[model samples]
Target: MASRWIRPEVYPLFAAMGVAMGICGFQLIRNITTNPEVSVNKARRASGVVENFEEGVKYADHRLRKYVRNRSPEIMPSINSFFSNPERSN
Candidate 1:
């Protein structure tokens, strides 16, 4: 439904912002629930279940970033190499 006060062009912007906020909120809640350091329960905080809290956090929320940590970051290797070559600058 279109409202007289809001412009139709602004709807997509609102939807994009809503989605971004939702993802951020989901991550925040996930960290609070799974990470012992941030968990609400005292028992889980002191259970010694995760010897290395950092590793545990990574494992609990493993994503594309973790899996590709070792790979080259260039999205277009050929393009990057072309621009970086000193001879090309001349």
Candidate 2:
């Protein structure tokens, strides 16, 4: 069994490679988690994006309501036609 195994002269090379890989992984995780400006900016940007999206939804809802009100006379016919029209079966 010993004769078929790797040579003893190269054992340290594998250990050094493992240690280097571990250090690189730890440093990458630390850089993402520990930077104060990056963390704060990320939170701020996420909240700003959420707020903007909420405002856009509200604005769209308001516009849709206004459109419905302005076209009240045609809304029922359009809805009825939408449900009963044979063309929709396709």
Candidate 3:
């Protein structure tokens, strides 16, 4: 059970605490492990590029879908061709 009268400011404080705890836990694990630097560095390096490319693809697909939704029927073929262009193909 929770009280409805709780101040909204408390939510952010709790959220921050949760994030801080998570970061501290991660650092603690990193400090106690053997070869933590190598494993963490490798993971970070791989994740950075992978996350960026994934985000780009996700946003591009989102924008393309939105464009298609708003597009006139007459321009459908041209739009499809533009997106399917070999130069831009992934």
Can you write out model 1's per-residue Cα lDDT over 1-90, one digit (the tens) per residue?
A: 448768989989999999999999998987777665565777766775556767676756568767788889889977887889968756
Off by over 4 Å in 1: 42-61, 86-90
lDDT of each: 0.77, 0.64, 0.63
Off by over 4 Å in 2: 1-5, 37-90
TM-score leader? 1
Candidates, ranked, TM-score: 1, 2, 3
Each prediction's RMSD over C-alphas, in Å, is 4.3, 19.0, 15.3
lDDT of 3 by residue, 1-90 (tens): 266656786999989999999999976774545322333565565754343555455544654587777766665776786787967654
State the number of backbone clashes in model 3: 0
Candidate 2 per-residue C-alpha lDDT over 1-84 given as tens digits, one digit per residue, 9 for 90 to 100: 775777888789989999999999986775555533334465665764343556455545664577677564664686687778
lDDT value, residue 34 of candidate 2: 52
Q: Give the Å shift of residue 24 in candidate 2.
A: 0.5
Scored against the true structure, residue 75 in model 3 reaches a CA lDDT of 50
Candidate 3 clash pair list: none
List residue ranges in candidate 3 displaced over 4 A: 4-7, 35-90
Candidate 1 minimal-lDDT segment of 10 residues: 44-53
In candidate 2, how many Å is residue 71 off?
A: 80
Top candidate, metric lDDT: 1
| Candidate 3 lDDT trough over 10 residues, lowest sum | 30-39
